[model samples]
Target: MVYQRARDQAELSAIQEAYHLVSKRMEGVPGLLGNELLRSAHDPSGLVVMSRWSDLAAFQAWEQGSEHRADTAPLRPYQDTRMEIPFGVYEVDAAY
Candidate 1:
């Protein structure tokens, strides 16, 4: 998940646009199952781009690839800088 903050509605729109572009670029990418753009109910400026991959190995492979930075650059400026780490990776322990 990548945490993001949009100061206002205009910024939010831009973020959404960027998300869509990134999604398009990721189409058919190996191991990328799906992704979502989530906005906070309490704090409208708070946003998160969550992507599901087949496994850690797959995600790491893409992240380390040459196109990774360019593909995700659009949202870089909006990343939540307050947190020490603005992103995280997790494995499902249990799911219904």
Candidate 2:
């Protein structure tokens, strides 16, 4: 997951637009399944971006790629200034 806290409504709009562009880029990525952007009800500026991929290797490849860097550059400012922005990778140990 990725978290964002924009400085204001304008920044939030920009962040959303940047995420839209990044999501578009992810659409054709080799093993990317899909992704969702969720906004916090309590804080309009807070956002959570979650993505799914075919495997850890696939995700890692994308994470380390130049294309990913280019795609997410627009979000760097907000990401850098945000508080409590947590990132992680988890094993899908169980499924319904």
Q: Which candidate gets the maximum TM-score versus the true structure?
A: 1
Q: Give the per-residue lDDT digits (tens) of candidate 1, residues 1-96.
A: 999999988999999999999899889888999999999999888999999999999999999999999989999999988779999999999999
Which 10-residue window in model 1 sums to the lowest lDDT? 74-83
Q: In model 1, how large is the Cα lDDT of residue 52? A: 98
Give candidate 1's TM-score. 0.95
Clashing pairs in 1: none
List the global CA lDDT of all models. 0.94, 0.79
Residue 29 displacement (Å), model 1: 1.1
Model 2: per-residue Cα lDDT over 1-96, one tens digit each? 777777788988988898888888667898889988788999877787888899999999999988887877776666734555466577699999
Against the hidden reference, what TM-scores do the models get?
0.95, 0.83
Candidate 1 wrongly placed segments (more than 4 Å): none
Q: Whose lDDT is greatest here? A: 1
